[model samples]
Target: MRSGGLMGTAALALLAAPAWAQSASSGDGDSFLGGEWQPVDPAELEQMRGGFEMPSGLNVSFGIERAVYVNGDLVANTVLNIPDIAAITPEQAAQVADFNRGRVVQIGEGNVVMPAQMAGALVVQNTLDNQTITTLTRIDVAVDSVATLQAINFSNLISDALAGSVSP
Candidate 1:
């Protein structure tokens, strides 16, 4: 009633062979996976710099320039500009719009504080007792976004935040 071990082992070995073979150091033309270890050339990677082909799925391009898009969830992002919430800065808006035009660079991080945090800090709390130990930590990125219409005065923002001039 329970004899599927060989199939499981074979499947696992097949999946793991690529990773194990890649790292095996063999000078005698031998591999731990019973195959020759082949080195991947850097030029090959460069040659396939653009989009990759999937056996099945959508065909996309490695487009990194401004373009008019349709029916796509496009978000404008940058490292040099921040949106002015008080009022939209024409220049910053244009930069974000232009940056989105490229349509290749994807924004991985979002949810920025009003004034970006200069120092990446984590808040941690730890408590211990004879019976139990409790630890809590929160990680957050405190950095400004790239697309700022104008320059930011960090000192002023910090001073104002500290003085309760502005509520975070």
Candidate 2:
């Protein structure tokens, strides 16, 4: 009879486990990463462009995410999703980095640079008044090598800063 009671208690505890987990996982609605994402407006994109000039013959898009959360608390208010460069061959990507060597600039709390092969893409982030403005420019210039692209002043466009701010 004692063993039967113990078995019943164990089964009850097992049933309650999922409930506990569900409640814990639910968290506060505001604490979820998915809940923080909101659509970015076109004007916002223009503002983020700041003084940077876009190189001709390249495609650009902007996306914004609300602050990041960790353990149900706000960690980062904004995250700039890096542009996709999956279409570029690894060798070409390396050349892009080499072409922009020594052009990486750091201003305030942010950085601007053409990152290396694995890093991929050109990025510029500048923080003003506690907000971070990030821009990732993916240039699409068909050429045999980075040198050929450099001939057309491609490095100038890849070497500019983006503007925006994220509040805490």
lDDT of 2: 0.41
The alpha-carbon lDDT assigned to residue 69 of candidate 1 equals 17
| Worst 10 contiguous positions by lDDT, candidate 1 | 141-150
Candidate 1 similarity to native, TM-score: 0.16
> Candidate 2: where is the Cα deviation over 4 Å?
1-40, 49-55, 59-68, 77-168
My TM-score estimates for the predictions, one after another, are 0.16, 0.18
What tens-digit string does per-residue lDDT give for candidate 2 at 10-93? 445545656764764576654334666654685655434212113543344443333333334443343333234455456545
TM-score for candidate 2, please give it: 0.18
The best candidate by lDDT is 2
Per-residue lDDT of candidate 1, residues 1-168 (tens digit): 133344345345545655675667545666665665465684553332234232333222232222221225333222223322245467646755554433232222433332233222222222322322222222211112211201222333455568785564
CA shift of 152, model 2, Å: 14
